[model samples]
Target chain A: MRFDLIDHAMAVTGAIIRVLVYSILTLPAILVVMSSFTNGETMSFPPTGFSLRWYRAAFENDLFMTALWTSTYLAVLVAIIALAIGFSAAFAINRFSFRGKAFLQGLAFSPLIVPAVVLGIGLLQLFAWLDLTQTIYPLLLGHLVLAIPYVVRTILASLTLHDQQLEQAAMNLRATPLRVIRRITLPLILPGLLSAAIFAFVTSFGNVTVSAFLTYGGRVTLPVQIFAYLDTSSDPLVAAVSSLMIVVTMVVILAIERLIGTERLA
Target chain B: MLAPMIILLTGFLVVPVLGLLRSSFLSGNHLLEGSGFSLEQYFHFFSDSYYTSVLVETFFDGLVVSLICVVIGFPTGYSLARLPPLARRWRMIIVIMPLTLSLVVVVFGWLIILGRNGLLNSLFVSLGIFASPKILLFSRPAVLIVLVQQFLPFMILSVMSVVTQIDPVLEQAAANLRANRFATFRKVIIPLAVPGILVGFNLVFVLSVSAFITPRLIGGSRVAMLGSLIYERIMAELNWPSGAAMAFVLFVSGLGFTAALNALAASRFIVRGRRHAL
Candidate 1:
């Protein structure tokens, strides 16, 4: 009875410790947003006042607006391009019994593991060799490299979950491959496509290490802007910009959740 | 269709990374400027304690953070697996939220949370836990906290997928055979769960080791890691060769660690399979 009692106490203690650690881990970003309410000169805890002026500053600031648009534009372009490539590759790998299928799959997935900094460096070097330094094309290509793996992974997972019999049935019915894909496979994998696209968007939008290296002053993305802004000034402006970005990100996440119901995403 | 992807992968990823390896070999005082290579950069990396320390730090950070993720993620993973099908849908949202969110946003969130005048300080003040705001940000502990938070979902989902594959009846059988719940968990559940746990460890470790932005923004200059060192060498100093060397070292070390773990996993899997076959 004493041993059982001791075990129960130990388990409870472990649970409490786990809870405290998890809560502490989740608190940092939330607290930063709350700290922005401080009307003081520097960021201070337990703000003397609460107002949304910093949020107002983030919107009104032209640089922030430019960076936001840049990030959004790049994100959208990256999604479209990545979807085109990733989907095609996924289709080819899934449908065909080709040589080097595993190798191709590994290649497709390698970008996810390869450090962003390495990708950034390699692309920077590649583009420089091609004389495309600090260009939008390089940034686009870099973002696509990062985004492709996510799209491929999500699409592959979806493809695996789906029935092969449907495609085989379509083939037996004398349907052309293109027609069958359009009429059968596309609809089945639309959820995956949607999920993949969301991932592509987020990957491109939130990229830093790769985007940071690729971006110049004229075409700085939101993260680069945030990094630069934080470096230059440790003020409420950065807090506001970060908060604004977070809100935008949260809205997109919520929208995706609403659209597909987050199960499809998982 | 795969041709284009294959070509892109070969040209951009495989070749460039290979080129980085070659670049690490070439010396400034070389026989040939373009082609002839020496072991100068590798020697530099190995010989210099400053750069070497960064490698060690990176490895340890990856180790600590991934382990923490496993510890935190296991129960969450179990809870998720046991959830009703309806509630299981929301579990992905919770799981992928951090994964999909921009690293900038995550690091920013950490900055806010761990910053001097951040959330914890205010909470502590209110609760009378601290007399004043404390400096928690930029510390090594803060990096682990932020990283574990960021990677926990990955670890959880990885384990949960495997856990769900397990038959609950095995647990019931164990119980029926006079085992307590804890004994059932230990004997029946844990062995089945090891593969998932190892996978989660590999994924999180790979991520944490190569991570630059997180360690940079949250950790400050005090917490030097290989990724950040490479960044400084390349971006700050424009020392591409040295930066490439550091990146190559990090890449090699990461590859080695994953390979070792995977070999360990494969052998263990075979052993388990043999036992089951028996």
Candidate 2:
């Protein structure tokens, strides 16, 4: 059989088309980041110069610092609380066959689909009624609601996929339920829980819609802070902050990818 | 175990939804007052042609965006799903990049690309496509592009999950029967993938309908999607009744699409069963 030149040419053409498609899709996001560093007062297409002035200004800005810390603290707090509560909820449902199980599962996952603005309004109303609107607690609670769904879903998936027979074997060996869970189930699903925590952390950290309504003068998240800055004052400083956040997020993603396989996490 | 979750959901999701429905019935004047509970808000929103037009436009946008996402996302997801199990990990990561990013960040990125002096305009100019820069930002098309990109990950993930569940042997059998490439795909793969495609459609529909930031940021004053309108009424107009009404409409339409998708899946199941019986 003769080697087919036409088929090889077609294969090369197909690969080229795929590359073009990917570049077309990804170019806009890269352009946005590049444009944010423009050296002009008004946003320009091509940069006039290369400078790190924006980073310097943003680093020196106290408002940005406060918002960054607030967001970090809120995300950490949300991750801890959500992991604690959501893990328990996931464990219960996976271990037992009980009434209203489907309903409970539905409820746990409902927040994932619920619109952020609607949830923001609901939380805003609830907090106002309880006189908790201005406090950081409401912000924390709102983030918790958002983050819990991810934790619950990942942990539930993990629990479902883990070997149930391992627990049975442990019980046969005279291990108590708690010990079996701790020694067997926990170890198996710990990677999942850890990965979920990271996902929840990034989510709460970067959230805006819910945080926008809930933010007071002193209780804004980083996204809200950047939004306010963008609304009132257009500066490269916003880009510096955003680029920093992107770096932080990318680092975390890379770390998680290395720690546990993305396949297992997915 | 389930009690806390159920209680929280009932108090939060169910009650708020009911409250939204109830608020949609009260008059604009007596919205906050406890006494007035009429169908005036609905009458206002439905009767006014301007508001009705907005609703229709938003609905059309949702449908179009959903269709586009499904068309683009399914092929990409199929490509990922068909990869060897060992190669699936990196493909999954690539698929989830958009999902992991925040909406605000995504919109921010779009702002740069769609801006008047943005990269697209620059590239177009360099390519000799236009004499001057054309504004692409804040247009309807801009909003649609960003939205499709934002939700593409969800559709991919959903369809990818179901695609992975389909048996490879079915395709092999179809090929063994002398079915060509397109025929094999149509007969063997599409039937198994109907549910996942419907799932992707429902998700995209519901989300595209409710997206706020992308429309507001990219659509600007030229376009008004339902979510942006709801935000305007609530925050700017201080019309809580109207906001609640619009929210109720969005929620209903979302559920409607979901229900329709479910019905389509169910009928498909019935048809498949009859075929099997025959």
Q: What is the TM-score of each predicted model, taking all chains together?
A: 0.90, 0.91
Which stretches of model 1 miss by more than 4 angstroms? A1-26, A36-40, A163-174, A258-266, B29-35, B125-128, B268-278
lDDT, candidate 2, B98-148, per-residue tens: 566556666766666666776678889999998899878768888888888
The interface root-mean-square deviations, each candidate in sequence, come to 3.3, 3.7
Give the per-residue lDDT of model 2 (tens digit) for A152-263: 8888888888889988999999999889978998999888888788878987998887787687536878888877766544555666677777766766677667656665
Model 2 spans > 4 angstroms off: A1-21, A36-40, A231-234, A264-266, B29-34, B268-278
lDDT of 1 by residue, A1-266 (tens): 22354447646855675565456544645655676676777766556687888878778999988999999999999888788888999988887797878988887888878877787877766666677775788788778878778889888877888898999999999999899989999899887787788778988888887887887537889888888766545777777777766666667777777655664443
Mind giving the per-residue lDDT tens digits that candidate 1 earns over B1-278? 77667666777777767766666676663221366667788898899888788788889999999988877788777666777878777556556666666677677767666677766787897899999888887778888778888888778877888888898888777767777656656667777888888878888998888887777888888888788878877788877777777788887789899889889877877687568536
Candidate 2 chain B lDDT trough over 10 residues, lowest sum: B28-37
| Fraction of real interface contacts that model 2 preserves | 0.24
